[model samples]
Target: MEDTNHKQSKFQRVLDFIERFGNKLPHPFLIFVYLAAIIIIISAIVASFDISVTHPGTGEEVVAKSLLSGEGLLFALETMLENFTGFAPLGLVLTMMLGIGVAQGVGLFDTAIKLTIEKAPRAVITYAIAFVAVMGNIASDAAAVIVPPLAAMVFYSLGRHPVAGIAAGFAGAVGGFTANLLIAGTDALLAGITTEAARAIDQDMLITPIDNYFFMATSVFLIVLLVGLVTEKVIEPRLGKYDPKYAEEGILAQKQEKVGRIEIKALRNSMIAALVYIGVILALIWPETSVLRGEGGVLVPSPFLSNIVPIIFVFFIVVSVTYGISAKTIKKSGDIPVFMASAVKDMAPYIVLVFAIAQFIAYFNWTNLSTIIAVNSADYLQSVNFVGLPLIIIFILVMGMLNQFITSGSAQWALMAPVFVPMFMLLDFHPAFTQLAYRIGDSSTALLTPLNPYLIMVLGFMKRYDKRSGLGSIISTMIPYTIALMVGWILLMIVWFLLDLPIGPGINIRLDG
Candidate 1:
């Protein structure tokens, strides 16, 4: 027991140091602002030396442009507004949120979660919560806030360790964040940033939101199994028997809310609506002569691919409205627009962040620094013969470490995709593949990072179960999930790579083999 306490003390110290260091860092928006300024300064210095590289695709001599010069200043002044408005992710995220906002606002998502958990059989309650949590990414970050507390309540009612339930829900909701059975808002957000980055190498390249669908869809099962196993086999056993003395007064007496008939009816109606909507979409795209089909009836580079964002918007709107009507959450048609507006209002911070990111990306592209860095880095990797699984594993590990401090997936990808996407492309890896690898690393480490706000939220839930719980307790419980996820996820990626499977529809792992 002394040795175990010693190990825990050592771990606590490490977590303390991490939290302190993370607290001292600037906000993500400020980080981008500082980075944009640095890029401008670096552009001037590089241009003064006339440093250049041969463009790998065009074979043209590429020279860096000085953002500090007269012409550069004119360009910046003219493009400021255009950059913000034309930013790829801005519209995609906003549009998707319009539908999602209404669904969440109408209580569709919350009711559905309650309905699923309350109906789960006693024999599979743990697995059910794990599955729902992992699949909840379809509802965006709201899952992080909703799942853990609800899971804890269910566990308490079932005579299980509530803290263990918190761990399981968090492990799936945040740690398995990137793995979803369907294309989510995250897919749109990240794909937009990736398309902009890939432009550095191929100007016409456009990465669709579904480019990583197959890989992510498959990962959902892997994450469900991993989270369930850790929760029951590792975390629950470690937590031992629940002690009422450690819990807050009266908390142990609280009962889980039973799912009502109205909620059941609403969920059933909404599910049926969702199926009909999917059927309509398939009917539109399944025929050889369908307007959604490509010239040769191919799905790739087709109207279906290009129109996925709008499809997501309409689908959510349909399903949510059905539930809203049945649940009496939306008494009038006007409520739909109000819900969408509220959703966009919630995205105000993201909108502001995008402004800074747009300028940084525009500046990076205008200066040709992205191209220069990518080409040179690609050449170096090739020269060392480190251009395969070994290189891919290293990239995933580096991303996992980076995720510890920079917790926002979009922000980190915005900063990284410009360089890594094109660099990997030069090494014969597809942009989609690079994005897939990044998601694996990013998701696996999300719960382990003290910087993730959701972890603190989970800590709050833990304290309700055990008043003595601290950040170290939450971190220790999550450590097993993070390690297991990283290893399992990375191994999954390796197996996918070795099997030479497509990550998405018509999206190969390599540009050419």
Candidate 2:
């Protein structure tokens, strides 16, 4: 009965999460705010009894962090606001978003997707769609905007049910988003949070966002193969082709714009430019004389790795700009401002949302919630001697399920890191292992959550091809691969833990002092 109740309670939480967010869960920033408010109200009530933790750091310290105090409350709010605004992801995200607008403004991007459909053959379309989805992040929500529509086009043109096309794209795009091998902005953001959490126990510990890049990059191929197999062997055969035989199920389709003369010219130039862009990167890394390579390797703290996101942005921007000019889609330099303005306008709501979140995080910190929880929890775990590889897997499962309701990777990490890092540190475990667990969880469950705003949008795209789909349809399809990834990932981590290999040159699970 207790087990049943436990499952039911979890289910109830999922429902509440859905109800509160409805179609849109509170933004990560705003979620931080609301959580802070809850903590404040509860702390206020708890403080009436004079309840307080003895400051665990210094034995003589008896510091009080009550949300009930007028000054205390204000300080908390201010701190959270500051932290949110200062979060590095904010700037990186905005810059990327702005850069993405250039590609969108030109008919260049839309043309590219349609052109992809014409390029790849039907049998390989499934894998191609998935691969493209992984590449789409360079364009900021381009997966949401382009993949679905492109999937429909691919399916229709090739005489397959467009719904299958839609699902193929949606699953590949989102399910694969978290697991990409290259250290993109998402890796940097999560890595920064992981580093923050890890440092709580050992001040000098460090972790790169792409610490597990080689392993993760390989996972991409497994995902593509699994998703493609499921799509081709199961989904396509079930849905049938897009011709007259499946006539009742209208695979509603549309025609793409022509390859106009100017676009044709632009296409030739852009393709050449794209090839050149890739060639230059190869040249840099291949011979020691080029820019990307540093003393040891290009993939290390090398300039190329650090600045890859910008390079990606520049590549897209230059190619798109060249296409725009050559194709006559962009007439003058003034059009650049117009594109930037439009993109920023779209981002206004997200910025406001993050602002609200920032305030809440500030409040919680001011109340000593984060630090206290982190310290005490770490102490408790140390006393119990419960930190190790096995514990990491357990938490991964918990965080993975939790991710269904709380979709933002950083938000979830921020909440858990303070508590987990300290505790794990006590057990002679480094924070990086725990963070790896978090990443695995955060990623595997991204595909299952209805709470993620993108989830529904992807589904709607599927509906354009198949009206009978739901969250279950998508989840069921990807379940096999999800299980594979979870199991395979944990197994690999266990080996690493046993080897006692250092996380990085100077980083370790426990502090030497």
Best model number under TM-score: 1
Q: Tell me the tens digit of each residue's lDDT in model 1 across 353-402.
A: 99999889989988999999999999999999998999999999999988
Off by over 4 Å in 2: 1-30, 41-84, 107-112, 156-161, 181-185, 191-212, 237-316, 363-368, 382-385, 421-436, 461-513
Task: Give the least accurate 10-residue stretch of model 2, judged by summed lDDT.
Answer: 504-513
Most accurate candidate by lDDT: 1
| Tens-digit per-residue lDDT, 1-513, candidate 2 | 999889767865765566466446655666767777787786666556554455443444323367778887577656665676675456655666566687778867666665665577766887888777765654556765678667777667777777777777776677666666434556655665666555544556555555546545665776677678777877778766554443235445375455566666788898888899888878768776556766665445566665555776677678778888887878999887788788788877666665655555445445555555666675676678666665788899999888876776667877777567656665556565567667777776677666777867766766555556666555555565467557766776676567765443334434441
Evaluated against the true structure, the overall lDDT of model 2 is 0.65
TM-score for each predicted model, relative to the true structure:
0.97, 0.74
How accurate locally is residue 505 in candidate 1, as Cα lDDT from 0 to 100? 86
- Model 2: how far is 195 from its true place, Å? 5.1
